[model samples]
Target: MVNLTRIYTRTGDAGSTRLSDMSVARKTDLRVEAYGHVDEANAVLGMAITSGGLREDVVAVLRAVSNELFDVGADLSNPLVAEPKWEPLRIPPESIDRLEAWCDEFSESLPDLVSFILPGGTPGAAYLHLARTVVRRAERAGWAAAEAYGLEVSAGDEPGGVNPLALTYLNRLSDLLFILGRVANEGVGDVLWVPGKDREPVGERARRQREKIEKAQDDLGRSS
Candidate 1:
């Protein structure tokens, strides 16, 4: 039961903040950065949810992800200890499995990907793509934190490490967001990538001129 009597605590005004374990750490700490990115990704997910035009099923999935993101943040914020005074909220492996299942469910109808996709489509889908990228960043930050702290389960009265499953959850969430984006773009179709389509040769003359220059340079190098 968490209650926020006041929104502003002014304690972090000095560039320091407390972790879930009540230990003080700099605002730029890797652990702080991991959860901070998770918060950022969650905010983008909120934007996607409110952008409208999403189907009820998609909205339901986004809502669930938003709530689960809080759990991820809690897991990241609370430092692991060998023997904590109480059990802490940790990201469970089953969450990743759920994300995988969602990905499969949503992707089943999407057309085969011949080329890479550009992010734009429906408003909700664009936002989902943005959220997906942010989630990738969160995953990277979480891994960095894990590298810094190590992944040893705390046993006694000792400092514990970040949950590896939490990092995996971020990774799987990103994939699900991508599939959801495609689902949101149903009927409109995905904005497929056309490699060099925008940068095609100006003309045959221009292409020939460039090739001539390259050949001349190669020949000159060989002669020299």
Candidate 2:
């Protein structure tokens, strides 16, 4: 069970804050940036989920992603002042394995990538793709912070470093999101694949081609 408290504390009026260890720092600290990105990613994922039409499996994966993101945020919010009395948060390798498995399973259900896809399908799936891109950016920021921390440690300035596994998890998570977007819109009739300007317009040639492809897919779906 969890305890709930709603009392407001007016501690942030000075643009500074306390970490989990009760150490004070500016809100614009790199640690804050790292955690802020994780929070942004989580919010985007929430938007994707609420946009609707996601499969139960996809929702489950997103839920897991949300939980893991919170862990990432918690890990970033506190920098080691001294070797803490408690264990530091880390992204385990098993989390990466789960992401890979889910990506593979979802990708198996999608058609082979013949052309570069424009990210649109269902609204939920489209937002998932957008969130995936944002997650990649966040992962890059996290890695940069980790590298800086490593340099600090190497210089004998600190005793702790960023979790390598967390970076790996974010990398795999982006891949999983791409596959999920593809699978989520499978067989949905409104999928519109935009052609390059060099390609023919939506006249007889394009219409005929689209009809042939969609017909083949419809037949395949019915047969299956």
Clash pairs, candidate 2, are none
Candidates' RMSD to native: 10.0, 4.0
Measured on C-alpha atoms, candidate 2 has an lDDT of 0.73
Tell me the tens digit of each residue's lDDT in model 1 across 100-192: 999888887665665577798689989999999999999999999899887887776556799888999999999999888878877467766
Local distance difference test, each candidate: 0.84, 0.73
- Write candidate 2's Cα lDDT for 64-120 as tens digits: 899999887776665643566566666677888988998888777566553455577
- lDDT of candidate 1 at residue 189, scale 0 to 100: 71
TM per candidate: 0.86, 0.78
Candidate 1 lDDT at 8 equals: 97
Whole-model alpha-carbon lDDT for candidate 1: 0.84
For candidate 1, the clash count comes to 2
